[model samples]
Target: MNLSNSLDKIKTFKKVGQVADNLGMETYVVGGFVRDILLKRPCKDLDFVCIGDGIKLAKAVADALEGKPQISIFKNFGTAMIKMDEWELEFVGARKESYQNHSRKPKVEAGTLAEDQERRDFTINALGIGLNANNFGELLDPYDGVKDLKRKIIRTPTDPDITFSDDPLRMMRAIRFAAQLKFDIEANTFDGIINNAHRMSIISGERTIVELNKIIMTDKPSYGFKLLFVSGLLKEFFPEMVALQGVDSVGDKSHKDNFYHTLQVLDNVASRSDSLWLRWAAIMHDIAKPPTKRFNQKVGWTFHGHEDKGARMVPGIFRRLKLPMDERMKYVQKLVKLHLRPIALVNDKVTDAAVRRLLFEAGDDVDDLMQLCRADVTSKNNNKVKRFLANFDKVELKLQEVEEKDQVRNFQPPVTGDEIMAIFGLKPSRVVGDLKEEIKEAILEGHIQNNKNEALELMYKLAAKKGIVNNPDK
Candidate 1:
């Protein structure tokens, strides 16, 4: 089918095609740009493959454009890129590839357009639209990519085994695309992923986590996690998450499967917010249950201290996965540790002191923590879920009330340690720290207002009880 009308809208396509025509090089807009056009997805990047020197064609096209935008050339890979007005255009020469058993990196050489299309990871991605003078906007679908796109299926252009084994990263890509597009992996393509799951060892943690994060960021990430679990790919990289898959029973009592529960919680959080780190907090909130799980005749099952344990586990997991060891990791860690706090308030009396402590600890993250806690309600009973959610609402209102009254979220002591030392004529010691702690606690407990006057009064009384008289004149 001719897509000339669509091509007409993108003026750069005509410029590139004219440049390639002048240079006598066959060129087509290929890969995701073409695929997204058919799918009607908003895309800003274009990938063009030419039968001749892509770099030369890139320079010619750059000069042909109105401003002669600067082009970046990768001579080693025979690829070039230029950015023009919210559009990134990439040019590459068509090439064939051969891979060794131990590496995913392919030995590349110049080849025909058909060879290049054959090497594509997925059928849909292999679809190309002509940009040459003669075949402008002509659809090229030698692998029936348009058909697979219509069916909403993920399939390889060639043998699945060859596709996956050559680059195991494609296995993750297959799953990511399926999750992102809400498409099903064709039977044979899925089986290929399961069969070559072991080959993931060759993939770097950085590369693997990129795909994993994309999957996690999807609308309903649980679907992707389930696919990863069933395909055995998750076990290859993240065994800790896989360990949460089963239920243990004692006589007639059994705990719900923590793995599926975590997924449900993830979906719940996803529905409420689009923050990736908050979603990550949901994934890790119960990650320690497998190790901390215990059977009790009275309670049936308990994952006591799982929150604290899971918080401790976050650093090591982040280190291994090559995730940033910055505030983002600490944010996830803090959320994991405090995930049970708001729930405890919902179960208990929702005291001002409890709310103060939670607000102080969670700081600016208090709202996100509440969101995670709300998502953690995964009971099957509708009444229980509704009751818990209603109680959470009450706890949230109390939090807001207390925060407005006390201003304890990320609160600092009204009296500094230096002020205490100077007021009491004492050197820096444990006594100064103890005095600061007392003031902070008294403010949080509502025993004293969080102000210099009330804090100083409490400090003087505590010091007098300790037989230390205030000597501000000293």
Candidate 2:
């Protein structure tokens, strides 16, 4: 397992080795960097664990670099970091940690390299590449991390229960790594996660969401989400999503399970685009189905107005999960509200007016919205899925045509309220607003062309009806 050639290729490794030798302290590149190296994955950040003062080694390495990169030292944690060009080097003292019953934060004490590796969350992550002069390029696998890597399994360095109980966030990391690497979680480790699922309550929402976002950003995010759902980790942080689970039957009629449907939509979106927010829209598009669900003998099952309800639910969910309250949140809300519009227009006799309205409402997000709608077609009926997809292609063509002709996506009226006020020689009043809405509705409805001349003429006619003067100059 000697990575002597690999170590030689990285000049910084030699520089750090030289610095550590000068300082007379043993150092090794540890954790993710080591794991990724063996996995042949591209990784830039290096975590070095030194048997002596990590801060001192970090300062020495920084000083030895070209720019004398600024070393950021954390005295409380016995760690330091430096950014060398695009590379981030984090240095930490070799230490063992003991966690309390209520907190994930562990009490740290200086220890050997083995102790540092023992504290790692996963065996695959505990692998290390020695950088000390004597053991340079040597591989340390005290936990048989190489075997876990070879088997493509996610397992903790020690007892699964103790590993997870110490930091419940590791449970989320386990699922994330499994999903990202396409690896299987060991049976005992999976059981340990289920047993310690409730312990995640001790983790803060902020910390939990970091892992959640990573899971969402993976190639097939739904895999991680399904893991989270089965492990009961999702219920701990997002009960709203949990509520979307299962289906109720009445008189031999039942709706598809919204939870699994959501996951399918998420996977579909993942296959099409890598936008995290788009995937989020898929997850949330049907979230209010539970509350809005109804069963009628004639209608079977209906989630009336769930879109509006789901849109309303987004803000609260974002607030609860500590997600961004900015435009990203607004984007998800907007998509949820309009998720049904494109589908509704997919039938025969689809009109340009409807496409124009969708274009106007969806604006720059029209493409993403269309992607989501296509992804939403998760029916088991192959013919139905084919029909919906063909219809969506038509819808997309209609959108393109309407956008090119009418130019109504995110349309502001050819005439503004202020322009209307000026044309009619009026102050700020309801009449002005009425006139602006009229022109916008006219363009979106295909009643009038999207042009200033057509809009001006219509404005003049409306002004006359309102008994306002059409004075160009007062």
User: Across residues 314-394, which tens digit of lDDT does each residue of candidate 2 receive?
Assistant: 999999999999999999999999999987876768778888888988989988998899999999999999998998898
- Model 2: worst 10 consecutive residues (lDDT sum): 417-426
Residue 189, candidate 2: alpha-carbon lDDT: 97
- What does candidate 1's lDDT look like per residue over 1-474, in tens digits? 999899999888898899999999999999998889999998999999999888988989999999889899999888999999899999999999999999999999999999999999999999899998899999999999999999999999889999999999999999999999999999999999999999999999999999999999999999999999999999999999999999888899999999999999999999999998899999999999999998989889999999999999999999988888999999999999999888677655557888898899999999999999999999989999999999889889888989999999999999999888888899999988998898899988889987889988899899988888778597
How many clashing residue pairs are found in candidate 2? Answer: 0
Q: Which residue pairs collide, candidate 1? A: none
TM-scores of the models, in the order given: 0.96, 0.96
Residue 400, model 2: lDDT of 85
